[model samples]
Target: MSVSPSSPVRNPWIVLACAATIVTIAMGIRQSSGLFLRPIELELGVGREAFGLAIAVQNLILGLAQPFIGALADRHGAGRVAAAGAAVYALGLILASQSATALGLNLTLGFLVGLAMTGVTFVVVIGAAARAVPPEKRGLAAGIVTAGGSFGQFLLVPLAQGLIGSFGWRETFLIFAALAAAIAVLAIGIAGRPRQQAGISTQSFGEALREASGHSGFWLLNGGFFVCGFHVAFIGTHLPAFLADRGLDPAVGARALALIGLFNIIGSYLFGLSADRFRKKYVLSGIYFGRAAIMALFLSVPFSPLSATLFAAAMGFLWLGTVPLTSGLVGQIFGVRYLSTLFGIVFLFHQLGAFFGAWAAGLAYEATGSYDLAWTASIALALMAGLLNWPIRDAPVARLSMEGAR
Candidate 1:
């Protein structure tokens, strides 16, 4: 039901806060995974590739499942899906702790974890936030939600590192499991029946895909987001290792990643506000271009504590900046009716890129004994993404809107 314009329920800040909290807690757990890698490898006697493959699988599976979860949220209620996801996510972590073999780990942490992630992450969180806020505020809401993930990275990574230092990695997983379980409570605040107006315009899952697939702008948006996945997943998963390789202490890399998370809060909020005031597509295009420029500068300059810190600051600003614009565009083109499902499909592409991004960095480093190639490819992708987004037509697609009523 539509709240009358004057109702307090329509207050944008209230909606933004709810979205931000959900994203923050969910993302915080996901960010802590990097802290587990070395410990799991040491305990299990698995090669880096084995662990890497599991993470890649997780990204791939999460991407694939996102659309389904998003569709369910759009069709039913985000609250129910999120609550279910929290349960599964907690269970997945608990299962991971029990897995004694490589295959078990793969299934538990890899596939099941990915499945759990879909319910809690951007797909569901952003969908609810979108419907809660007005059209003009959607971009800002998306940014706030995305920033919550960054906030998670900032707040949880250090906590994970401390946990690893104090307790064993296996126990860490157990603790994380408990935290995931707690999200079920938060889900209550986010859950409810979909507003009647939002449901009435939702298309079937297949129809939303067909509509998105047919749009050139959607393709460009997808392709650009692919680069975003590449940049973020690569750096998030492997930057610590790179810092260690450059002779900085391991703690330095961890701190740097934490800094990225902390600083990204500012970046995400600023980018979101900019999207609200300006044309979203252009804002996204500029952010991509900025990434390309920053990556180039970072690679050209000699690596050092100062340079690395500066690079992290610059990149953090661009990190997840696409979220506000990309998600906002989905709502703009399709309306909020089927947004979760449609955006989840788009996120699948993003995850596909993330799988490669995270997986490829490991492979590239092992093969070349350096991460230069991966870094270069990231820069090129950013440039290509900037170009591709430049031409996207952001006006509503009327045919799809009509078809959504069926």
Candidate 2:
């Protein structure tokens, strides 16, 4: 028997590969931004609070733009939007390299890069990949695309460190700008065909938004995801400084982040598989609970290089594991027609949490000369997030159910 010319099985892998690679470039560069914080602040003679505020703005803009970008992807094409994002992102990097003040950095890195990321990152790349694959394979496909980000983190963090060390932060940004521009060329592979609006009238965008707004489970998912953003952004942005405060070598922080990235590859894939086989809400709850437990253990133990390494390994495994389950749940409850937009709405909450996490950590440390308060808040939020996911009803929405009945 020959396969049909239009079968997803025939070309799904190719699309997945392209989506994953595009995600790798976008996420790797974003993740490595933390490594430049110290160097940039020192060179520019700015306080940590100012730099952290800039990153906070970036996260805020990324979240705010997600819904619009996702809508654009749903209407136009993921490839075009992502390619355009890459061009803007590269421009932001180039301009950021020349920025001498916090305000300039806020415009270039905070607003432009953040806005560009909405197109190049999950909402566009993962959403396109999820649409390209069969329903059963979406969990795995989302996982693979997300893992690409982890792989980038593992690969690029060290490379970024080397670049910053060898040349300078300005020169490093230039090199990264070139890489970002290259992503525009690579994005063509995952563009897929244009949207076809024939047989799929389950819900209009307004209807879908209204339905999601009325659903308690949807709010629960958003709440849980908010905690995820807070934890991830805070740690990713501040871990290096935290480690330095603990008297560990700078290399230890880099190594720790690398370990997290490496283990995240395993965790993302496994959780993706788990979501396919188990209750997605339960899986998400477990991830959040596990994060809380791991953080508690790390805090209880004495601070040392060995302890820090162990913390990194444990935290890395749980780092991005929430993404697959959260996204899968969104697609599961609502159909894929509006997946990008719905998920983008949820992501806005996540970014809001991230803004506070990144900015507040800096403020707390600056005021108190310690990260102890941030650590406590993360643990509390993790526990709260776990509780939030526990009660989320993961059943299909009424619209999908009605469509299925018909």
- The model with the greatest TM-score is 2
Tens-digit lDDT track of model 2 for 1-406: 2222222234667778888888888888988878888898789998778888888999999999999999888877788898999999999999999999999999998999999899999877778877776677788888998899899899988889899999999999999999999888878777754353345454677988988889999999899989998998899889988998889888888888888888899998998888788999988989989999999999998888999889988999988889888999999988677788989999999999999988999999899999999999999999999999998888998777766665
| Index of the highest-lDDT prediction | 2
Badly placed stretches (over 4 Å) of model 2 are 1-10, 193-202
Candidate 2 global TM-score:
0.96
| Candidate 1 C-alpha lDDT tens digits along 308-397 | 888888888778778888888888887776788888988988998889888888888778998999999998998898988888898889
lDDT of 2: 0.86
Q: What is the lDDT of candidate 1?
A: 0.81
Q: For model 1, name the residue pairs that clash.
A: 79-191
